[model samples]
Target: MATARDNILKKIKQALVTKVPVPFSTHTETADLFQPSQKELEIEFAEHFTNLQGRFSFCSNQQELTEQLSQLFSSRKWERIYCIDEQIKDSLILNGMNINPYNDLAGCDASITGCELLVARTGSIFLSNTTSSGRTTSVYAPVHICIAKTSQLVYSLEQALLQLTNKYGNHLPSMLSLATGPSRTADIEKTLVVGVHGPKEVYCFLIDE
Candidate 1:
């Protein structure tokens, strides 16, 4: 009288057995994975970032940054620069350089913005919606320029995330982006391409102050 389904169910039930649950603990201690000194982090980040084809520069103060900017602008001949950060704006103004307000990304030669943190392990820059330029500014322009202070550097990605969590708490930004270098792709015929989806050139102005 037992159907195939009934027989299968009975066989499955016969294989079942109750066992005591293993005791579990929520906490576990582990050795630190990243504990590099500040100088080490700076060196590693610069090396990695340069390997990824990113331009890196270190400045000691606002005056040094201004000088660097002047040299860079003169060499690159960037005429239509778009900047959103107030500090960068003021710096440019003080340098007697003209800055264009955000209008269309197509019209800008470069875009300058500030980042939340720089990851030493990966040579990545983290940005969030809370940044002055928001999410699109970095990708929209032909060239992306980041202004980061040395104190904002973290040894690893985990530390960077912890810093963000502590700073934002429950009110975290809507999005967090970590950019390692200029955008690149190799989708067509296995040929490598750069800057298809984002900036072709990425420059970081690292301030020691």
Candidate 2:
């Protein structure tokens, strides 16, 4: 007597021999999976980012960014904001932010860094190891504050990757990360927990370029 598996295999082989019309044969490969949005890229990014629980802010200029940072710091009483990027540090210092050199990361309340590209479609922040901030600065901190420019925003992941390739040529960074929002994982007991592995709060300051 044949086994149940043999019967299933025989049926599958017979079905394979019976050819049918291909589903949606007229559909082109270039066809978009999602409908095109009328909203601006900035607005779309902000909407998706906020929906992902990311704190999004649009700054008219660098001065506005400074002011917003000051307000946020003051309101949150955040004292230890660790920054490894020299340019960002200079900007903050020039803006009159009291930043003391932090040797221990344990005392750090937040971290400020720059990202490679901001994906408008997914509201993801694409990051590479090119910046002085390195890898640890963004993730180790409880709160991550990313200072991005409007010029860095791209429509999709493919666009971002293409730009990255053009920017870096053959010598790409060893690691590339796309941070969608504040890091969270629902692993243990299926209970959604925030900041268990990475940042609890993610703030993106998009400055007009």
Candidate 3:
């Protein structure tokens, strides 16, 4: 006797195998989001952060989120910090930590932003680039921190792609960054070095909704 979940999955798989298009455009749009399982994504994200050279931390709520993040900058003695979006900006200001908006991208020691969603399938954070400040704040700084709600965590890349298409309607941006981990390179002797081109550190503050 197949369970309801099993039956649904079986039907979905059959549709995929047969290339049967879903009648609803919305459902059809969500078809290919699978990548890796949730457990796999957690493992991958943990492993990547652990082996990373620079600073890294993950928080599951606003209190610890603020503490860990504030500690990151304070420990590093980062005086000039910039942030994007209202959440981080408000947090910093309320906590008596000064965070300037990204008027000048290249000069900040760290920058923070909120993400649309986190694709657990690939350990990637999707930046809409809907606002110029958010894009540059994430990319240009030496250290980048992103705040995401746990409710925003989706199982697969297909979910993320579907959400983007539905929300933005096709005018996605000139640049869409799917950052899996910190910017890294194996330049000399093929030895991996993190923070080569972009932020040396990518800290995720996962707020539980």
Candidate 4:
């Protein structure tokens, strides 16, 4: 007269008799893990980024950066560039590029911002709301330009997170974006479409100085 629910519960209880808990151990040594040099990291990052259809460039100093910016602006025809970061704004002015106010993010041809970290292992850039650009500028524009220093490059995602944790401690940004490449999707009839939800083009300018 027992209900079907009782039969299922009884069977589950019987199965529990043979169940065993597994023990886990942790290791502290990572000596066997392969660690690449900074130069090697840069090489890997550039290769991976290029494979993902991203544009990558390097600058040794502010002069080179300004020159690169000039050429980039001319090549992309970016008249109104959305930039919120103070440092980036200064750089833009120094480079003689037009800077659009934050209010006109949607109308701008491209956006330039500073990133928290660049993951060399995956060629990804990490951003946070805590940055000067907040969060909208990076994703709202049709073309996104990220400026990062060579020192900001990390070997892998784990190292990036560890560094962030060490730097921020308990205070972390409300949002973090780990952008790998330009927005792309093949949702409609398996046709590849770019910039459907975000920037169609992404450029990373790595400054050595």
Candidate 5:
């Protein structure tokens, strides 16, 4: 006797095998969907990121990046910054910053993280579980500081996804996320609220590589 679950599975399998024709289909399936970007990837990304209320800065070298971060730290007076990447933590510590490389997300003033790729058109930071600064480190902190290289910048999400696939041929990260800007919601009374579910402030430091 066929049960309801079995019948449902059978129907689903049949649907999966059945090919449905589109009522309105374009024969040019391989054509590009969006117009070409007019400006440089970095410039476009910076503009879009700033428009989304995300702070963007460019650093010429590691020394410049350190100097810029130190200045920002003094300005903001961030005492408890959480960073888990050993390389970044070491660099920060060597430059006289007190960066702890342990799991301390609950009481961090800010978090510094590394991204997998950056989407220029969307001004989004693409992250994956493969990095030491995983999903939670980027999302949970009140302030998120993402360090990205100019080489990681791509024109669109599709390009980023393609790069990611090429970078990790057969094995992709278990999880992937895009941080377009700071957390925001307008669920209650239609009033826009930022930092409701995630970081209130987002800063991206683009290093020329």
Candidate 6:
């Protein structure tokens, strides 16, 4: 059942995997780097996120995460929700949540999406049009909820690049966005204002799986 095309494709894939160099080694010359533990890293990430113009919250469980967010906006009388097209949409539906996909972000209470990748050091999430079902859903909405997997966390941005290259080969995504917090501007009388062009609230849920 094997054709010449199939054989060649397999060869090419094997070659690429074998030839691609592992850029960094686990061994480090510097011994006193003092890397923080996982708990410390999460705390550091939370601290960095709050320092930005937007308010952020981190949750470990799906039920608690959704409840907390729903309550936050429900208090403000927000009910409609908009979401990007991704795998998480089903999870939301199962939780008795409804999502509007085609409507403009201004019509919804929040936007939810998955990050293309995540950088652990700076607690940043990278979003790309190709990977994240385009950027408008995450960028235009007043509230953005980003769901991330624990396995996707990288030690640094450098490691992220390597993982990306490994996934897509030499050709990279056209737009690689690195988002640490909400969009802000200090234009009016030097007063800080959140959600100028992007989401006012960015909640990150680091899923255990």
Where's the lowest-lDDT run of ten residues in candidate 4? 23-32
Report the C-alpha lDDT of model 3 over 1-209, residue by residue, as the tens digit.
98999999998899878965657767654555345544644455545445544234556567777777667778989877776567567876786655555555688887777777776645677776753245577878888877777767766667777777887887877667777678988889999887788888887777657
Please list all clashing residue pairs in model 2, or write none if there are none.
none
* Candidate that would win on TM-score: 5
Question: Model 3, residue 178: displacement in angstroms?
Answer: 0.8
lDDT of 1 by residue, 1-209 (tens): 99999999997887775454656432224444767765776788898898999999988887788888878888989877888678779876787766656667678988888999999888999998677377788988999999988899888887888799999999999989998999999999999898999999999999886
Candidate 1's C-alpha runs over 4 A off are 1-29, 34-39, 95-102
lDDT of 2: 0.87
Every candidate's lDDT: 0.84, 0.87, 0.69, 0.83, 0.86, 0.72
What is the C-alpha local distance difference test score of candidate 4? 0.83
Instruction: Give the best candidate by lDDT.
Output: 2
* lDDT tens readout by residue for model 4, 142-180: 999988888888888878888999989999888888988
Which regions of candidate 3 deviate over 4 angstroms? 1-60, 95-103, 187-189
> How many angstroms is residue 134 displaced in model 1 relative to the true structure, after the best TM-score fit?
1.2
Cα error, residue 170 of model 1, in Å, equals 0.8
TM-score of each: 0.81, 0.82, 0.69, 0.80, 0.86, 0.70
Find the 10 residues in a row with the least total lDDT in model 3. 48-57
Worst 10 residues of 1 by lDDT: 23-32
lDDT of 2 by residue, 181-209 (tens): 99988898899888988899999999999
The residue-by-residue lDDT of candidate 6 on 27-107, one tens digit each, is 444442446556655665666666664355566767766666667667877666676565777776667655555566777
Where model 5 places Cα greater than 4 Å from the true spot, the runs are: 1-31, 94-102
RMSD of every candidate to native, in Å, equals 6.4, 6.9, 12.6, 5.0, 3.2, 10.3
